[model samples]
Target: MRLAILAAYAAVISTATASYAQQSADPSGVWLRDDGNARVRIAPCGSNICATNLWIRDTSKGEEAGDRLVMSLEPKSPDTLAGTAYDAKRDRTYSITVQVSDRSLLTRGCILGGVLCRNVHWQLAR
Candidate 1:
C-alpha cells in the first residue's frame, strides 16, 4: 500500500540522518603530538570517548609510555572541551581542558589537588 511504502521511506531517511549525525559529531582520529614524537588514536568508547596511545618515536619508552587512557569530554563551548585523564599507573586522575582549532588541539593537564600541571599542544594527523 502507499501508506506502507511511505512509512518505509521515512524509516530509511531517519536512520540515514542519525548515522550522519553521529559521524559528524565524533572527532575520532589519529592525532600527532606537538613535539612530533607521538601519536594518539581518539575514538568513541561505549557512551563516552577515549584516546589510546598509538605510536611514539622512542621505541624502548613507547612500549611502556603509551597505554589506553580513558577520558570523558564535555564541550564547555563550541571550541573548548574539558575532561579528566585517568592514569592507571599513577592511580590518579588529572583534570584536562582542551581548546580545539580546526586540526590543532591545545591541551592542559593539571594535578587534581595542586597547581602543578603540564600543557601540550598537538596537531591532527592526516
Candidate 2:
C-alpha cells in the first residue's frame, strides 16, 4: 500500500525531471548589448546556462566588465530563462528574464522589488 504509493510517486517525479531537462534551451552565443557598450558570451555551465562578459567598447569606465553577468539560470521554456543579472557597474543584482529569439535575446532586469526595470534587446554578434 504505502510502499506501492511511494514507488509510483517516485516514478512520476523522475519522469517529470527528465522531461524538464530535455526541454531546456541553449542560448549559447556571443550577444551584443543594445547600446553597444559590451558583449556577453552565454554558454552552458554544468546543468545551467551562464553568461560572461566578452568585450567592452570603452576602457575608461574603470569597471571590471570581464566578469560573469549571469549564472545558473532556470529554464522556463525552450525560448525563455529566468535568473539574476549582476550589474558590475552598479554592484547590484536584479531579477532578470531572458527570452531568446531568432536573432536576438530580450533581457529584462528588475530592481526595487520589481518596481523599476530595464529591457535590453541583445542582438547576436557575428
Candidate 3:
C-alpha cells in the first residue's frame, strides 16, 4: 500500500511539472516594438488568451487610443501567435501575426482593408 501511494504521488508530481513546463514555454509576457512605438502585454484570459496595450511612444500625433484594443490571440504553434486587432477608432479588424525569436517578438500585419500591410518588427523591452 505504501509503495502504491508513493507511485501515485510521483505520478502527480510528474504531471504537474510537465504542465508547468508547457506554460513556461509559451511567450506570454510584455513585448515591445523596436521602433519604440508600442508595447503589448499578453496573458491568459479565461480559457482563451488576451493582450493589452502596455505603452506607446507618442500620444500626440496619429495615435489611436489603445486602451480598448484588448485582443484574443490564438496559439498557432509553440512559438507563433495569431490574432485579430479590433481598432476602436475605426471599428475595423486587423490581422495580427507574431513570431517569437528568443526574447524578441516579430510582428507583421496590416490595417486599411488589408490592401496596404506593413511589417512591424518588435523587440523585447528590458
Candidate 4:
C-alpha cells in the first residue's frame, strides 16, 4: 500500500509538470510586425515570458525601443496562450492572447475590463 501511494503521487506530479510545460512550445523568437515597422523579441524571462521591442519606426504611440511586455500565460490550446501582460513602463496591465505558429504570431491585447482592444500580426524575423 505504501509503495502504491508513492507511485501514484509521483505520477500525478509528473503529469502536472508536463501540462505546465505544454505552454513552453516555440514562443522564443525574433519577430517582425506585419506593418514592416517594428521588430520584437519574445523569450523566457525568469518564470514568465517577455516580448521586447527591438526596433520601432513610430514612437508616437508612446512606444520606444526597449519597451517590454511581460506575460504570464497559460496554455489555452496547443498553439495559443491566454493570459495578462504587464507593461512596467506604462504601469498598465492588459488581457492578452498569443497565438503562435511556425512562421506567424498573432497577438491580441485588451485593456482591463475588455473595453479597448487591438490585434496585431507578426512574422518570424529571419
Candidate 5:
C-alpha cells in the first residue's frame, strides 16, 4: 500500500511539472519591444496566432489607439513560428519567423522578397 501511494505521488508530481513547463514554454503574453517603445500582446486567433499592439510610449503617433495587427504567426516547428509581420507606421509587410523562449522572443523579418532580413528581440513582460 505504501509503495502504491508513493508511485501515485510521483506520477502526480511529474504531471504537474510537465504542465508547468509546457505553460512556460508557450509565448502567450504581453511582451515589451526591445526598443522600449511598445508592448504587444500575443494570443490565439480563430485558427492562427496574432500579436497586437497593446500600448505605446508615444500617443501622438497614433500607434496604439487602434488594435494593430503586428504579427500573424503560425507554428512551423517546435520552437519556431512563421508568418508575416506588418509595420503599420511604414505600411510595410515582411515575412517573419519568430523563435520563442521563456524570457525572450527573437524575430527575424525579411524584406525585398527575402533579400534582406532583420532580427529583433523582445523581452517577455510580467
Candidate 6:
C-alpha cells in the first residue's frame, strides 16, 4: 500500500538521522596556532571535545595560558565538524566549523548570525 511504503521510508530516514547525529569527526591532538603564538590540546572532555590552551606566546588580549573552548560538534563530513564553541572565560558562544586533516585544522567561528566571524588555522605540533 502507498501508506505502508511512506511509513517505511520515514522510518529509514529517522534511523539515518539518528546515526548521523552520533557520528563525529576526530579533531584530537596538540596543535600549534597559525601565528605560532599559541598551542592547544584537543581531546575528549566529558561528552564533548575541548581545545585547551597549553601555551601562549602573546597573552595580552584577554587570552591566558589556560583558557579553553569547549566544543559540541557533529560530523559535517568525513573530515569536517560543525557545531558550537563555548568560551567560558569570555562567557560567549559561537557557531563553529572545523575542517580536519592529517596535519592541519581550519576553524571558523561566527556570532550574530554570521555577522562576525573569525578563522583560525592550526597545525599539528611537532
Highest-lDDT candidate: 6
lDDT of 5 at 110: 98
Q: lDDT score of model 1? A: 0.75
Residue 113, model 5: lDDT of 98
Give the higher-lDDT candidate: 3 or 6: 6
Q: Model 3 Cα RMSD, Å?
A: 6.6
lDDT of each: 0.75, 0.81, 0.69, 0.91, 0.79, 0.92
Specify the poorest-scoring 10-residue window by lDDT in model 2. Answer: 63-72
- Over the stretch 24-108, how does candidate 5's per-residue lDDT look in tens digits? 3356789998989889888876665667887889867667644555666666666787889777667988898889887999988
RMSD after CA superposition, every candidate: 7.1, 2.7, 6.6, 2.4, 8.2, 2.6
User: What is residue 13's positional error in candidate 5, in angstroms?
Assistant: 31
Q: Model 4: which ten-residue window has the lowest total lDDT?
A: 19-28
Candidate 6 residue 30 Cα shift, in angstroms, is: 0.2
* Worst ten in a row by lDDT for model 3: 63-72
Better of 4 and 6 by TM-score: 4
Q: Give the top-scoring candidate (TM-score).
A: 4
Q: TM-score of every model?
A: 0.70, 0.77, 0.61, 0.84, 0.65, 0.83
- Where is model 2 more than 4 Å wrong at Cα? 45-49, 58-65
Q: Which sections of candidate 4 miss by over 4 Å? A: 1-13, 16-20
Model 6 bad stretches (over 4 Å):
1-24
Q: Write the per-residue lDDT of candidate 6 for residues 11-76, one digit (tens) a residue.
A: 999999888766645889999999999999999999989999999998888787789999998888
| Tens-place lDDT digits, model 2, residues 10-108 | 999999988986876667899998988888899876765667778888767764456776455778987888887665556888898889888899988
